[model samples]
Target: MATSDLHMQLIAYDYVNDRKTDGGSLAKMASLIRQAREEAAETGALCILLDNGDTFQGTPVSDFLAKHPGTHPHPMVDALNALRYDAVGLGNHDLDYGLDYLGRCLAQFQAPVLCANLKTSALPMIMPHTIFQREVQTASGETISLRLGVVSAMPQLTASWNRHQLAGNADVEPAMPSLVRAVQEVRNQGADVVVALAHMGIATIDEGEDAQNEIVAIAGIPGIDAVVGGHTHLRFPGPDHNGVQGVDSETGLIGRVPTVMPGNSGSDLGVIDLRLHRPENALHPQVVSCTVQLRSVDGETPEDTEIAAVSEMAHDKTRAYLARPVAQLSNPMHSYFALARPSHVPALLAAAKRKAISEAIAGTELERLPLLAAVATPATGGFDGPENFVSLPAGELKRRHVAGLLPYANQVWAVKATGARLSGWLERSALLFNVLRPGDGDQMLVDPQVPGFRYDAIYGLTYEIDPTRAPRFDAAGKAISNEVGRVSDIRWQGKLVDPDQEFLVAVTNHRAGGGGVFRPFDDAEIVVKKAAPLDQALIDYLKNPDCHDIRTAAPWRFTPKLGVSAILHTAPEALEHLGDIPSLHPEPYGTTPEGFARLRLHL
Candidate 1:
């Protein structure tokens, strides 16, 4: 065949088939593959499709695979093999289901699985690199030989998991060295092109610096042509730092070296078109030009029909798994972000944190004092759907719903803080607040209208925040407000709290570790007490409550409207209720009430 007729198209993507439902995006992805294959066939070019990891975990299918080992089939593995993938890299999520399951998936895949980082006591089937040399005859009756070498590497953080099930031997620093050696071996075997199909994140930053020192350090070594990276979910355009576009078969920009990362979850496809040049004087071929293109998955084109079919099957399987009954609720409790501050979910979460912390400090010397304040961060937001309110109908609540609510599976922790320290914590939580500048048109980080992140903690002691006052702490954690936002009206158990006396504070592990935009609490001179899981506490608390109705109690009041003050108090009438048995009133608070918690304003 003529040199111009000989062409190879390399496509890479992270197919997250295990998590998404078959009928949704997964089906769309399958359709995309079919279309690509048809287009490639017409061009008389060989299309080499590759996956850069994250295939195993995320959705109900993964959960089913974990629970019922031999019963549920591996959806991702089957889908990849059906598409006839050229190669796949080992991802961190692949180890989530354990090494045995990963091994099973690898065995089932028809294509070669490449990984230089992962190690196992069991071997022979698992190889570091795979070299493919094929001679294809064109329609004009001319044959051309093409050689390709592919090697892969997983990230170093995979070692944090249980070693017994997944062996992530902590010698990942030697991956680049081994990869260079593998490239030499492939070259010796007459491979024309050497490709490092790495499951590593791209290192380049916009400031013209290689942020990932490891990848940059590896690119400095010789023989590796192109590095297809993953993990960080970043998108790179052309020849990055270290050299020219390495993988370019046409015009070798950046000294004939190219690096690419296609991002994650079938979001986009990384297409690399390379052209090779053969000089009359030299026997070895050189990469001339390399061009990279990003095709978005969310495009207008119709998806692959075959892949879509498989996705539908997987969706059916997932729906069947999620349909199983777990627990019954007596009352319908809605997880409404809008009503959290004025309703009971936040209070319930705070109560759970308080209970968990109280139990943790039961035998400790600090357990005697009354548990004063509890704060809980809403880990799951309604960004995808209804952030304000997620209502559960009166029926059996499946395990999926519970998992959806508390997705992180975080533990609760309690620490003792003085009244001043408690005030500091609240200030940190208020970091979600962004001061409205004049003529700003309401475009701020924290929306001034959204009440979710704005909700304050259910304090055991009464205190007030002057929104008009400036922040007390500067960026360096030093006191800067002078006397602004002072914590006045502070009372615990109807008595003024002493600023010198220490009080126990309840919070979740996420917030304690400086999550929820809170500052790092590691410097606090307080004892750290580990507590029970927050989700379990929520489940238990729900069962133990005499009334499932979420009611607002006294001392918890908010100024809903300006100039017109309203009191939030539990009413005799019950509102919107759901569940098997109506155990509690749905409407807990009254719009207007007399003699509720007093908040005297000085005008």
Candidate 2:
């Protein structure tokens, strides 16, 4: 059995909404683990629990714990220990806090912690792989000792993403070479079954030279027996995947290898049943058959009492920390229709970033130039679900609300870029929408393939997007066309910006570090690199009355096409905020089967 991208959801609480979410948390999925283990025991099968990384470092609770250092046993470590995890693989986010902090937390793990690709002296305790030798009875009542060799590796971008934490102490090698060596090393150690715990998604998610998801490649390796994948926050062996060359999307088989990628935040429990048989003349057991299952978790699912009890104190403390007042809100804040129209949610974030960067570069030469901030709504009714939105009432704002607005633990960074780069950045983000034909009616507005977080809206400049034209950049931030593409009439300060004009842009380290697509910032010079994460910046910004009366209206719009209409899928609560975007001229169509409310926008 396996879990991936748990993202610090040891409990069932949603700090953003300040309520208990229905379909998340390791506590809820703990029941499924117990059930699977019981079934395996009843059938005389070996049930080993493994995690596919990104086990921590998300949510308000995670931030609270990371900030407040303590000598107490890490709640996640305790929970995983109590749950009896056989082995745990490393994900990119696991190193987000720092190598030192991560190493400290990892030291308490009762099971083997694995990360095959990373070469970090700071985290010397992390092993490349581990061999678990256990005895399982065959159907004929013959006792057989099996060596289950589990080799793990994550994306090479782990070091690139967390450079601040591991600049001098560590470096991550490319996945193929690192994993191949680790797999061979384990194979040489006399292993019966080789399971690749890959902390990555399938190749179809991202294509070309810098493809991040290497699940397909890992499955193609000769020594790998069964594979477990994650980091896409998606499910496998289901319709969520499209068939690739060696991947069987319908059956979750990657090159005849049974694979499973359970959904993130404990939404699903991935189970792979391997029927192994050893011949009398053979030295090792062979996997004769394999079955992969992704069990869904819902509110009705029973949570493990022990798991919840173990993390109760931390859960209660997280609630109190998020409840502390930051400031008062003039009105409710939400990002339900951030894609369909300009909204205040992202505008508020942009304003805070601008303030932080402005102060950080006070006397520096970069501060003398025009400053801008690029930010996007993290919750835009995408893979995180429709309910994954920021919804705060018109009252005192709290830390929890800020967490909903900016969920990631990213520090703000300042970059110096020319107008050309800025324009290219916006053009790259414009690809989030599908080109709408003039004569078409009820066409889909946003491209579901593009991540909403990558749809950044620059606050220092105003521009209009013409999606009727082909996007200059592809979803991978690669240039597919030479045309200016989509973004047009960009004005920095009531005037059109020259291509060579320079500006100071405030952005997250993840963006500056090229976490996602739109990597034009490579040539941009770094001006300021602050150690503070975004949540802390926003909290400080809100506490100050100077930044409180900031602009709420966004400065961008879609190029209107007569006789053309598009369907926008957003949260159902968007119905109440129709007045928030009178420009969209939206009409309620209905709700999608996926639970997102559909709105018909007449362009």
Candidate 3:
């Protein structure tokens, strides 16, 4: 019994967008971390807490920090510091404000922020990898030193998403090469095990240069013992999501690699346990066995009182900030029929962007081009659950309401686009809808593969979405439909859209920079490449005295599908406003497995 068995525990989570529910509270995670450490101690195993990044910039509190930067430490970093997180990888959103701000915010963290692929002049804040040396007690009551080599990296799209912010400040390398080299270096540094803290998603699809969702491929790289994933905000150990191959959603195993992806927003904790053995003939510490587990904060784990106390001030201020009145709505805002048409929320956003852009270029050369605002439904109940839908009563639009609606802190941007390119953009967005065959009975409206945020609805244009037709573009914006058009009868400013006509479309920086597979946007001529956050722009638009009782123009509609009706599962609250959208012919069909109320839309 001279050589004892070592139990290595790795826990991670991603896309914890912001602290709205108890499910994703860092305080709750703190309690879970403590419980995990206690359990590991009882079993004579080792426990190390690692974060998969996307820590800051999800909530109004984080947004406030970005808007008003100062010497005060970020609330998220404060919580992470108090929790004593061993290390954290960089998430793409971590650089939303800028590289310098990210560095400053990360400075307060007690744990090292690991990101190997990001090559930056600021080396003190970020590095390729790090070796954590710890002592763990064995079952035989013997303590031994263990070296955990951790290499963290993110998708190359960080360069694209944060292009304006990272243009010259930093650059990102291909994750695989950077990861491989780091693994070798850490191994050479007398590391017993190598773990990859990847801020990427588990994707079977080719990731191209971005490598944003390449966790499955990363597991196959040599010298890696385990992986903790993030970015896609998915929960593994559940089911093969979005057609990702080689992943056992039931076991959280991808190609024999033990992995964990705790659902985003502090909702769950991803735990990977590795049983290490030092065989007499073995050259290194071999992981003879591995197990993955997901721990959710579903009224089971209590919130850490201390951690909660530390963030209470931020929480209170954000709550008050969100409650402040900004404007008034003529009608209620909801996303139940956002996919079927340009619903109220998206319509309002587009109107705001249109107004903002029009004002900015009133006398400029760009004013001559037809103006359109491209906006997606933000409050769609996708990752945020059925209750995630935006349902603001016809009253004052509070800051909190905007936070709930806009969600992300994406800045407003305007791009010059040709009619053909705009058609392709809409076609790409149309991919979100499942092809509706004529006379087909109630079918799911949305394609689970396409996220709600990518479903762009261009304002200032009237078009019909023909469900029977194939999308002119795929989810990646490739012209795969081959003349079989999904978007048809497009009219700009009451005239048929000319394919060669030039126009300026308002979009978020996230969209303009190719955050989604919506291509051509990135190549489009930049007009207003930088502006205040979209939500802020909307706020400004609303607060202006000229705007009173705003209403959606309802410029888009679905081509009549006689017997083919689409059903969208949304929050039960949608039932109250079934009368508002007469076009959907909304009827409560039933409830989804996740308890979302299914409303059938007669297209």
Model 1 Cα lDDT, one tens digit per residue, 510-568: 45544433443553533553466666766665555534333543233322222322211
Q: How well is each residue in 1-603 modelled by candidate 3, as lDDT tens digits?
A: 000000001111111222344345667777777888788878988887888777776766777667778776766777777877787788787777787777788778788878999988864778789899999876577888999888999888788888888887789888888999999999999899888988887764554444468888899998899888877877777763645678888777888788887777666777888888888886677888888888877656677888777776666666566667889876566777677666767777887887778877877898888888888887677765786677777777677777777767677889999888888888878888898876666778887667888788888888988876777765545566346777789997678999999989898888888877766355448778665667768888876533332363666777764457877878888788777778667888888887798887877
Q: What lDDT score belongs to each candidate, Candidate 1 first? A: 0.51, 0.84, 0.75
Q: What is the C-alpha RMSD of each candidate to the true structure, in Å?
A: 11.0, 1.8, 4.7
Residue pairs clashing in model 3 are: 16-265, 24-266, 322-400
* Global CA lDDT computed for model 1: 0.51
Over 315-374, each residue of candidate 2 has an lDDT whose tens digit, in order, gives 889899988899887667778888877767777777778888888877877768898888
Which model scores highest in TM-score? 2
Worst 10 residues of 1 by lDDT: 1-10
- The prediction achieving the highest lDDT against the true structure is 2
Candidate 2 colliding pairs: none
